[model samples]
Target: MDQTRIGTFIAVLRKEKGLTQKELAEQIGISDKTVSKWETGNGMPDIAYLSPLCEVLDINVNELLSGEKLPSEEYLGKAEENMKHLMQENQNNKNAGRWQGLVGIALLAVAVFLTFGLSQAKIGWYVDCPSIILIVCICAACVLFSGCRTKYEVVHFLRKTVLPAGLVVMVIMVPALLHSLSDPAAIGPNIAVMVLTLLYAAVAYLVLYVAETRMERRRKQN
Candidate 1:
């Protein structure tokens, strides 16, 4: 009933057979321009030409009309199973993303409190210790959140294994950086923390870049 869709399907199959518009038209006994119009969905082929056109394309009548490749019974069952799995995966990803956002916001609030409250209180060695720890924890959280937003391919394994590794590094670095902030002699650790924070932000940006690349590839493939 959808003549435009039918025409488009015919055009695609014609091209896949490596036949030019003129060649296809001649083989089907139609004007070359008529093939062009059909391919462009501007017009439909005459009912009389439909059967012979399918014969030339080496496709069945149903295939010509539907445009979907006819799958074997076994393949159709597998495809349905895969579709269900993909739908469940998408739902899980959405729930995980929501939870990650909430946790990241909570961690950021804690970081802000430690950075401002402790630094201003000027508790020589004690306050700086916790402040540095909080900042490093924030950085680790940002990395985890970035992984949550990244595609299944790049971050999938890393999110499960390597992200927790980052937490360990954060635990060691934060207190050391905070301790350095209290002592004028050890300013290097404070500077290192700033540099590491910048790098973490850069990593987050890289994740977005990777995600965009994956999106573009999917668009083209589709």
Candidate 2:
């Protein structure tokens, strides 16, 4: 959209209607300064103000966005152009969401590998510490990524990502657990760490679910 052209159109329409900027602004419930800004190409109306402004100017929203007084015969063409622009914008957003999902999955996989590596070592609470931090951080990244807009999508993404990777960690840990079981000094502590890791993973899943649900609600409201 061309702001300057739209502003000029607004100014021209106001003059043709024989109304001052202040009077037009009054009808639209905005300050005269806002009308001045629009006319001078310094600003555009908010989404909420678009309808009222268009009504006052005797123009449709498409004409306003296009920055012109469209001819009757060209109206449909202009509307079609606007629709394509909107669809392109939506496609771009979806592409961004896909990128975020890929990154989230990759991060989750890395966290899983780190946990698996830690399981083979004799580190005490450090195993839980770094793994817990990674789980928390990755969960936050998932929520922030905007990759899953619906509950089903969110769960599917987690299942495809977290569950498979988690299973790999478990599969690799089985042999280690078996070996540790034969060692009296290692058995109890290793089981305790595994239990703590699983508990933290569950908590991470819960946090992601709640955060994503809140975000979805907010997105819908907006």
Candidate 3:
């Protein structure tokens, strides 16, 4: 199941039908950009879209999976090959995700260390640097990796964690920030502190939203 070969097949089919990329995408209820990506081999169509797309293009799903026209007798073999390719791809993605998860945890650990080290420094009298860093890092990590799960038995975790914990940190920060801003020297750092907090919140929400939407699409497909 070579993407480039499959993409070329899709493009040829669409052109033979006298349909523009936008026209084909309209029929499939997808963006023209997605159609373009498929044709250009920049990305493969999602599995969920494959059936509808094959229907629109008047091609058998096994033939599309094979990236070529296949004889009826060859359908099972082609499908088996496609399944193997898909499984390998899934495993690769999972490995990559595990590496990313490790990196994220390492970052959190460094943030914790820095927070404690900063607390020991004599540089600030108004701000609780350690507390702020700890709260922000923990919240951001939670939001970013909220979808990660462990094989556990009975506890409902995410509902009692992540967003609620974030809210608690925000509540605590309000008064802490107010007090810190009362000092003239603390004004500059406090402004930066506010910006960092907002930036983290924005990024976390964006990542979470994108993750959730992709998960929903996959679930619908399944």
The lDDT leader among the candidates is 2
Instruction: Estimate, for each residue in 63-179, the C-alpha lDDT of model 2 and write its tens digit.
Output: 987888789999999889876765665566668767976897898788877876767854465456744655545544665584777665766466335533434444555677899
The best candidate by TM-score is 3
List clashing residue pairs in candidate 2: none
Task: For candidate 3, write residues 1-86 as lDDT tens digits.
Answer: 67888899999999999999999999999999999998888898877788899999999777887778888788888889888887
Q: Regarding TM-score, does 2 or 3 come out ahead?
A: 3
Per-model lDDT: 0.62, 0.72, 0.70
TM-score of each: 0.31, 0.40, 0.62
Tell me the lDDT of model 3 at 202.
49
Candidate achieving higher TM-score, 1 or 2:
2
Kindly provide the TM-score of model 1 when superposed on the true structure, using C-alpha atoms: 0.31
- Arranged by TM-score with the best first, the candidates are 3, 2, 1
